[model samples]
Target: MKFNRRTFIKRLFIAAASIETFFLIKGSISKTHLEKDKKELFNAGKADSFEKNKPYPFLTGQFFLRRFDDGGFIAMSIKCTHLGCIVQSNIKTGGFNCPCHASQFNRFGEVLSSPATRPLDYFPITIKNGDILVDTSKPTKRKSFSKSQLTYV
Candidate 1:
């Protein structure tokens, strides 16, 4: 076996290609496993942790957890109903403002202004041992807010 420059170059290229392929395959496998076990349950901390009349963003800014003055908790989806853009909370206006289309929604997920035909979406909330659990898997779309939409702890 004579050591040649051509042979050395070929072997080095093969080794580098093999290493790159291995890493690509490994990363894809890990990503598939993570996607398989994707969970939508979000812990909003204790039921009492929320402040009254204030909105708290949770689960990577996916939803807003608001504690009403009447001691009720509601999880409103941040996604705008019009174009699916994330809405920002406007405390001064007491509503949510969508930067994409200028759609406005009240604190209860009702449409305050248009371009948005329907109101904002909401997630179901459960109180277990004082811990607030929000189910992002189940989303409810409504035109108005009702007593059933609120979760009283």
Candidate 2:
């Protein structure tokens, strides 16, 4: 076969396209596997370690574990409902602030300001052998706080 410029360019394009497609498929497959292998439940820590009226931000997991004055515990997601940006806890304001869109939410996850039409998402909490376990995989979105959402030790 005689080597031509047109043929060489066509072959190069084909090889480049093939390589790109392969990488995209490989990345998607790996992402799927990672999602499947993710842990559903995370151990927050011992029940005693949490202090009343304090919010413990789990930065790695993007959630907050708070203890109320009544000895009640609640686990809430940090992702803002408005734009999915991480909400930061403002202890001075006793609420959460979404730096992305300025959406505000109270410590109870109730929406105190606009932009975020709904409250922050919360994960169910379970105590097993005195260890507080939070189900990070499943999150419940609510507009108001409920008695059932609180877990008492």
Candidate 3:
């Protein structure tokens, strides 16, 4: 193969484009499957182990788990739906609030203020074998909850 600047650049561009396309497709597919396979691939950190009387650290996202007064579990995302900034969790308020613009989300990820067109995203969680697993990658329309994903004793 004879070396040429134009040919090298063309090949490089093609490679980069192909790689980007592959990743984009992969990401889309995963998002579609977010709800289906969340429980399977979450062995490393299960979401079902979280207890009812405890609020647990979530997978790197805008949510945490806490037992509701009625003895059920609520997983709330801390991400601001307005700008994607991490929502601040207030132990005093017992809810997640966005400091970036003062957006407030209830225990169930509902928006309590304006400037947020959509509600805070919630993940389907479950507890299995004493760990907590949350599907932080995508938010599903119908949510599931389990404390088996948190890797806490």
Write candidate 1's Cα lDDT for 92-120 as tens digits.
Answer: 97789999999998878889889998888
Error of 2 at 109 (Å): 0.9
What TM-score goes with each of the models? 0.72, 0.74, 0.54
lDDT of 2 by residue, 11-35 (tens): 9999999999999999999999999
Q: After superposition, which runs of candidate 2 have C-alpha atoms over 4 Å from their true positions?
A: 1-39
Error of 3 at 50 (Å): 5.0
List runs of model 3 lying over 4 Å from the truth.
1-54, 59-62, 141-153
Q: Output the better candidate (1/3) by TM-score.
A: 1
Per-model tally of clashing residue pairs: 0, 0, 40
Task: Report the number of the highest-TM-score candidate.
Answer: 2
Ranking by TM-score: 2, 1, 3
Per-model lDDT: 0.88, 0.90, 0.61
